[model samples]
Target chain A: MGEFRMPSLGADMAAGTLVAWRKQPGDVVHRGDIIAEVETDKGVIEVEVFDEGVVETLLVAVNAKVPVGTPLASIASAGSIAAVPSAPSPVQAPPPAAARVHATPLARTVAKALGVDVTKVHGTGDGGVIVRADVDRAAAEVTSTPRPDRMRQAIAAAMTRSKREIPHFYLAHTVDLGPALTWLSARNEARSVTDRVLPGALFVRAVARAARAVPELNAHWTGESAPPLPYVHVGVAVALRGGGLVAPAIHDTDTLDVDGVMRAMADLVDRARGLKLTATEMGEATITVTSLGDRGVEVNVPVIVPPQVAIVGFGKVVDRPWVVAGVVVPRPVVTISLAADHRVTDGHRAGRFLASVVAFLEDPEKP
Target chain B: MKREDIEAVVIQKLAKAAPGTDPGSLDRDEAYRDALDLDSMDFLRFVDALHEALGVDVPEAHYPKILTIRACTAYLEAVLAKR
Candidate 1:
């Protein structure tokens, strides 16, 4: 592409505002054809197109303020359409996202949040893999959310490091589980509902269901090294029923079901209450789920917990007024937070994952 | 370093800095653009490498004066003399 900058039509012209662009973006123009009109310091001047081809980009618009030499329009070469030139390529790059099989959850979040497109962000770690620090550094370059609370502080440190060093982004869903919970309750009542399906277990089950649908969400960040293991570990944050919070996760939540999540949630909550959590439980988690609001959150951006590239928060389930078919009805609402590393996942992918989570929560009767 | 040695090092280092094309057979008389077919980035890379190699501070004000190969030789000689 060739840049057509605002020129000093006369010696009197030091700067000129763009009065209008006669040719819009992608409009074809031949050499010497006037592409735009500029109001010069002396008079209105017609800026001519230099090369022939389609107008690839117009940096300034009609009534737009501009300076001399400020690139106003760009034309493609002979028969060449000016595509947004990919930012000058950084030396070595990553392979495609589809080819990426196993990365740590934390690494994935870090990558997605950073908008680095994990598939393209070449991994320097062992086995051609991308790591936590890569995502951390990338996140730091973007949104630097500083220290606030203990979990928030730990999360900030982890994310700051993730953004600074790693890359990540997330998709999310504000789910409403009143209907699903009602269904579970109805089934329980019909069968003399003994175990009151803990809301956290339900939330975990919802996570498992959605993850199974999108295996990409169930992935782990494979560290900086290449040739690494390619599976996702599921992290579940448990608010100790008595005091404090215990978020020991159920590794590989994608492979498990509601029943498995129930057992794991029970075990973790028990251990967490007694302060019996281990280092592996704390450090090795690829994803973290905090059910501060029980089923989901009101609104949240869960911090990516270091090596784990994704952290999802489930807020409290509340009964509120809702609209359905133009009628006001008392219904339940749930919100979830999907704070991820922006480097790998775009907002669109993260939005889809969140939608999947919402879809699973809305009508969860499954095989 | 001799003037020829300095110029050779600058050209060689510039080629590796951007990772693609090299400083195409430059000489004291050749214009920088005509010699290497360089764009702005290539020139910037050359300046950065030159600064790194010689451990001297050069600023943007020197760009217009030292853009050509002959001009670069003159600028380096003057800087070396001053140091």
Candidate 2:
């Protein structure tokens, strides 16, 4: 039998609460099947099972909080004699509702005072247990805010650790978007409104291509050494409508064209805002790209998210005076900035990476 | 469709585009992009939602004319009237 453990969804994630289980004992599970939903500081992530087997036992109960590496379930290998038939005979029917409801003492007191059913109020606390605030929110019937405070705390913890541990070197290059815009306009004019690609897609594709050319930039910083990832999974930083942000990976980004990037981005953004991202999408970023699209910010100096060695930032594209062939002329321009870990790469390598990005953006037609 | 109906459709699409945001809180005259912190992709999605709901294809050139709730309603009104 193999154990399915609670996955570390990010460098910052320490523990996650088991919100719900998609599979019960005796259910056949595939290698990539989402077995459970885990709630972390980032949000509720759909956790996938890497082992294809029949679930023998669910070690963790729904709403139980477990640390990274804790075994959540056991699975019998596929075709094994222990693999029960499709009809699920749960080894353990989830503990009775009375016994399953985990809540803090304060929460119980508050729920009693407010005449709220403690069992009915979903817990946002550790291990899916109810806390005092949850009781109060239930009492007041406020459902609009979805734990933005916990998300903010998560961001704070990650960013704080990043700034403290990672010695970052920053570089910026201004790329003329005149060529790109003209190319995009011509390409978009022929397409329907829904099919048209945005400049942001071009930016992501350029970053992916540049990362492929300069592989070192697409790597993770283990304390001992920096290793380049085999594939470029470029994480796009998406701001949540509920007040935080998540940088989920667009898997194998280097293989996608601009239109593919656009479609991927649209789907990713929709799922991200819905808080339905998978565990791999949450954790496996080789590099990240962030943009302040059309908000008029000319540049941004980003901080590297730990484990990932580099992050690329793009500012708003605007009109600027350009010197073309020794003559000054108006041109659309955007500033691309890179924040890389100094421990892994130097300014020279960082500069070359930025140059590659510039080259790709300047000649967008090149596959 | 009536102008009010167009406005309701715009609000519904906006809510769909930026899921967690409150459509009722949006200022009719204020730019939806700025108010909702919507990036270019989100705005495109809002436009796409409008297209799906109303069968109105908003061209790229006319994006600026529909940045606000009031503006979007008026633009859709003009387009639907012509249709």
Candidate 3:
């Protein structure tokens, strides 16, 4: 039997409310299938399971808020159930039917820990089986604790942990956006509005390409420093209309062209605002990029999301004096800043990464 | 299409692109960002909807020229007349 645990969608999430299950018992499941919908601070994320198996049971009830890493279901691994017991199954002994209560093991454990009588706890699982949610609900009814905003609380805990653990180094560079804007304008001169690329997408692509050149900066700071990722997943920070922000990854962003990046970014941003992001999109980023250029902020130093070692931020682009070829001239410039985990990389390496980003933008024709 | 007809199409598309936006209250000469709270993505979708609805192709070079309600209608009127 294989256990399917609740996925950690982000570093900040300690628990998520299981909104619904997409699969039921006896269903054949494959890798990468969205098995459940989990509501987090980011939104209702479609949670994907990573193993191939037949679902044996759903361990958590819908609307239950459980901690991350709690097993949500049990599944029979593929090819593991083909051999049946020929005779009386001498190796295994069946429990007496009188003591058998249709309850998940995790639920029974919780009941024991909380000193709650298992027989009295209401069951809401398949065939009236007690699940973790029943214990949680029973506990809640007894304690009457006020429900806090789980998403907000999770984000706070994660950010606090990130700040406490990671030693972050900050660097900023003012890059001339004149060449990039001119190239983009020329490219879009004949295209329709929907087909035109946005500057935010351009920054994402540029940052990805830069990370490729300076591979050291594109990494996660897991206990031992793992090698830089072979491909880049650039997380674009999108502001939700209501209140919170989410930065979902655009997978393999460096390999895509500007137009491709723009399309992916638009789709991701739209879906993110609607709370329809998948688990892969939520947790797969190697690095993150945040842009507030539209808001007209000149410079910003964004915090690093945990596990990921680096974050890049862009501020408002405005025309300013530039010394090109030793002569000062008016040109559009934007401040690009990098917040990197000092444990994995130093300021010198980060400087190279930032410069590479600027270099790509300066020659927008390349990527 | 008449100028009124073009304006109606524009307003309808804007209203659909941005929910809760009062298209009827939009100032003809005010920027959509200030008047309708339409961001760049929403504005782009509005322009695309206009093309899809009325067959008016808005070239990127003319984006600034058609940023406001009055300007968009005027530009669309000229393009439709030519077509």
TM-score of each: 0.42, 0.87, 0.79
Q: Against the unseen true structure, what C-alpha lDDT does each candidate score?
A: 0.57, 0.86, 0.80
* Model 3: per-residue Cα lDDT at residue B67: 83
- lDDT of residue A326 for candidate 2: 98
Clashing residue pairs in candidate 2 (N, C-alpha, C atoms within 3 angstroms): A65-A127
Interface RMSD of each: 32.7, 1.1, 1.9
**Ten-residue region with minimum lDDT total, candidate 3 chain A:** A84-93
Report the lDDT tens digits of candidate 3 across residue range A69-142. 99988777888645322232121122344234566656754554344555778899998889989987886576
Q: In every candidate, what fraction of the native interface contacts is reproduced?
A: 0.00, 0.63, 0.58
Question: DockQ of each candidate's interface versus the true one?
Answer: 0.01, 0.71, 0.41
TM-score of chain B of 3: 0.92
Candidate 2 lDDT tens digits, A278-298: 999999989999998566788
RMSD of 1: 29.2
Q: What docking grade applies to model 1?
A: incorrect
